[model samples]
Target chain A: MNGKYWVPAVISVALMLGACGSTKERNPAGGTVPTQTSEPYTDRIAPAPAPVDGSYDAAAAAERALSTNIIYFDFDDSTIKPEYQGVIDAFASYLNANPTARVRLEGHADERGTREYNVGLGERRANAVQSALLAKGVSAQQISVISYGEERPADPGHDEAAWAKNRRVQIIRQ
Target chain B: MKSIRYWTALLLLAAFPAAHAELEITVTGGAEAPLPIAIVPFSQVPDVQLDIAQVVENDLVRSGRFRALPRRDMLQRPNTPAQVDAATWRAQGIDNVVVGQVARSDTGYFARFFLIDSISGQQIMGYDVPARSIDQMRYVAHQIADLIYEKLLGQPGYFNTKIAYVSATGLSHQRTFQLIVADSDGENPRVVATSREPLMSPAWSPDRKQLAYVGYERGRSAVYLHTLATGEVKRLVSERGINGSPVFSPDGRYLALTLSFENNPDIYIIDLRSGTRRRLTDHYGIDTEPAWSPDGTKIAFTSDRGGQPQIYEIGIEGGDPRRLTFQGRQNLRPSYSPDGRSLVLVNLEGGRYRIGLLDLATGDMRLLSDGPLDESPSFAPGGAVVIYATQGARGAELATVSVDGRVRQSLRQASGDVREPAWSPLIR
Candidate 1:
């Protein structure tokens, strides 16, 4: 916590750390520093910049919720099982239907990774859903996301059946 | 008073070197050869009939830094400071020596002890502590180890503290959760709460007077704060969406929690004094497990802001968030060491969740816990150890590993499965 680290506290500074994701802003001792100032950050991973339609259609919006556990992933990920296009699509449509209605996406994990890592993973899952919904024409103003860090497991058991259920993205109303 | 004399000795020891006013954890660097030392039983008040010497020796050994000398090999056990013969231990290949005695008080008892450099024949450090002030003899022993640790390692010792964790045990087919508190060494487990439903996230207040955690009852999860003295409990957060993951700042002024009441799950800080809440993260993505650094300037939380469930750091008030973890395909539940210098996190490797420590400096990571499943890693306030949920032989149980992965112990009762283990701050 103290800014000075080169003295007697060398080992502890090394305890709570591991390698970081983006290495652009590395510290002198190699710790990563913050980049974006926004709260609900949406990483700009240029996918040819999807065209902005600026149109709202209730039926056309992505499915707001799904009874299934199928989610989608951008590349290689077991988190938020990516094929959730339908769920994202439904949420997009719901957002278009009611702009005033605020909805939140709760991200979750499969109990496979560290709980804290899964929290960020869950957040990433929720963020991915939010971004995907935005691409399908969902307004950012009405949607929010939070990661539970594997604290709220949909399935409490330790087996695979439970892990699949634990790795999820629940949509909640504000 | 003997205890007061020990306090003065501690103060003098602090003035010499290796004492910290603020509690700090001393993490051992990479796998180095362990240090060899000896702690000879100190003399005590006549007829007191308590030997806390072995207890002090045990704590130091658990640090993974010291190799304690067996009590049977001791050539002598001295009570008075002048009686300590550093040469005797040095001849036995012991590097350090500790000796002490006990004094009786109107209420209970008082004790004084010291650590010496056996090789140099120098008075490394010495202090006296009130045994009566310490209802638990283990804490008094921890103080002895802390003095020796400070004299040698120069970091704040966390031996004289406790950890709060949930223990579960039942029919292998049935599940239950029980909130239990025990010594850092996994001794004296006393249940504070019990139920068939699951209990998660055992967090300690800054003062260590209260604990905040989430419990499941009647099929719903709610956050509750339990007082150790009164056993009185109150709900801090319980809403329509999941309301959980409560962590306290160093100052114990506020608690950062995950709440879905605002539609999307966002991170919020609740004032324990007034019940006022402040929202810190607003991303459409999930943000949970907000851990405060020792200084309380920034919060290290698990967020997928980038696109994966990676770790990120955000300001307490609000501002830009910087990504922290990137090594494994999956990482989360980053708990800061007491000094906020390093983080103990659960990392997913080869399809297993293991405990790992991230050096805030160097961006390098090292695997600490070896297991198929690990979660909810909570750091000791000093950052020397971490307690988290793990899948043991039976079911879910609470396990601990020193930051260096040298010392490991698991706390399991007949309850059912222990999920979250939070280390309490030093208060008493």
Candidate 2:
């Protein structure tokens, strides 16, 4: 079961490097680029950046993708949203390239439900991300998962906007 | 430097309030009109610091079943039965009158009180209570209130019991969590545990000598049992995956908790003395929040096996799980009432989460709270009231509602969020 994931992990690392090199060549002045790409791998194989307007800068877009660590989820669900999958893929590539790299996934939920059950939901979310990374050839030993439930919130407001930010899995590099 | 800062923060929290600030309660709803009553100022040879009559009055008022007459309305102060003028109280439309006196005794402060029927002009009940110190005087008042409640309402009073809750202050990264135990009326709040990470799911042992809760001290969820008298904390489980929702059995012999070491959350029971764990649920779906039935024969918990979160019950020895809830979008956090006939849980309905009570026999559920975001419904000792956490204007505050859902009161802190209220069992 464990051996099946190593091949994709190696391929994702190659894809990660290729994408980074391509972005640098396209924009020398370090400007932001449109997140979307027309390549076929963008849809099925790898996390494709979102489509943006012509005014988008390539360099800034690349930096934002690389720096973004938090992955948000839908209400009461653990499946990684399509938009956030790219963020998880970036971390997976970084960890696969540097085998010794370690990161901690801290899962959180909003203050809408019971605390303990939210903890379980948070764990499921974190584990979902961990599974994605592991499938990308990131060693299980290099990653850890912890669920903070609704105890920690990125936005403390009780409204939907705040709750959307609170139900997230934060990837912290160790 | 980090250790120093942590200790400094701990010291600041300790210094801020060794005892919990009295929770300001506001009664919002009630089914029946409150009975008019007066608690006369307790006469003392040398007046004590504690206001025994006021504490009793607050307890009665918070119950939403009694209307304590204003002290100014009392025509005269009476300390004994002989001094009581029932006709005067009856003229004032008072139904009952309580009069007491505090006197220094050989062991401690001795308190003697009498409950009088204003209309009948007869003493209904009388008792003498002893307190070791001024701090206990508050508890003495609670005891008196309990007696009065039982006599008039025919239900056990929760005033003399204690409550455990999690208090969070600050924001996000700098948030501080304190596991606090306070009197039922929100007095004498003591910090039993503190951590920069979250501490939650506080369940009092049957004996009230310890608390079993989940803490994130090591950056991962772990179940911990904290002994109150000795200040001793023992970590019961800290495995690779989740270790959350540790609740003691009715007999206090075992702790039912959730662990996901196998990559799926499941319910497990751990014997406290032998340290043996028995897995109860082996399903792939999430199985957590294990609440023991009052008889200890069955365990009710929240599970998502039915496609959405719902309450389910299984025997102690483990068997086919029976689904217990179906009316809401999701149902979670099931806590059995003392009688074991019904359970209270958080039910998501119409996009708003509220507290719901489920009848075990008939499988009928009733929504008991009207708040938008109410959670963690725990039954008071006698099943007369259910205390839960509700989101208020300032932050999350504690609220209590009667079983009939007519009477409601909110216990708000001065600042910070106070939640996860677990009412202690009746303390003799």
Top lDDT prediction, candidate number = 2
Q: Candidate 1 residues B1-428, lDDT tens each?
A: 33232121101111112111111122333225667777667666656654688877767776777777888888987765577687787788888777777777776776677667777777767676766644555667777777777667777677777767665555423544567766666666566676565566788888888888777544345788877776657767767555677888888889999876676567899998999998999887767878888899998887765665678898888998899898986677788887777888878778777888899998899988877888778776556677777787766677667767777766654545566777777654
Displacement of residue A17 (Cα, Å) in model 1 is 80
Score residue B85 of candidate 1 by CA lDDT. 83
First chain TM-score, candidate 2: 0.63
Chain A TM-score, each candidate: 0.55, 0.63
Q: In candidate 1 chain B, what residue range of length 10 has the lowest lDDT sum?
A: B8-17
Give candidate 1's error at residue A71 in angstroms: 13
TM-scores for every predicted model: 0.68, 0.85
Docking class of 1: incorrect
Candidate 2 accuracy as lDDT: 0.85
Candidate 2 lDDT over A34-132, as tens digits, reads 444455222232356333333234333444566888888899999987887789778877787689989999998988878888888899999999999
User: Tens-digit lDDT track for model 2 on B355-428?
Assistant: 99999889899999886999999899999899999999888899999999888989888888899999998886
DockQ scores for all the models shown?
0.17, 0.58
DockQ of 1: 0.17
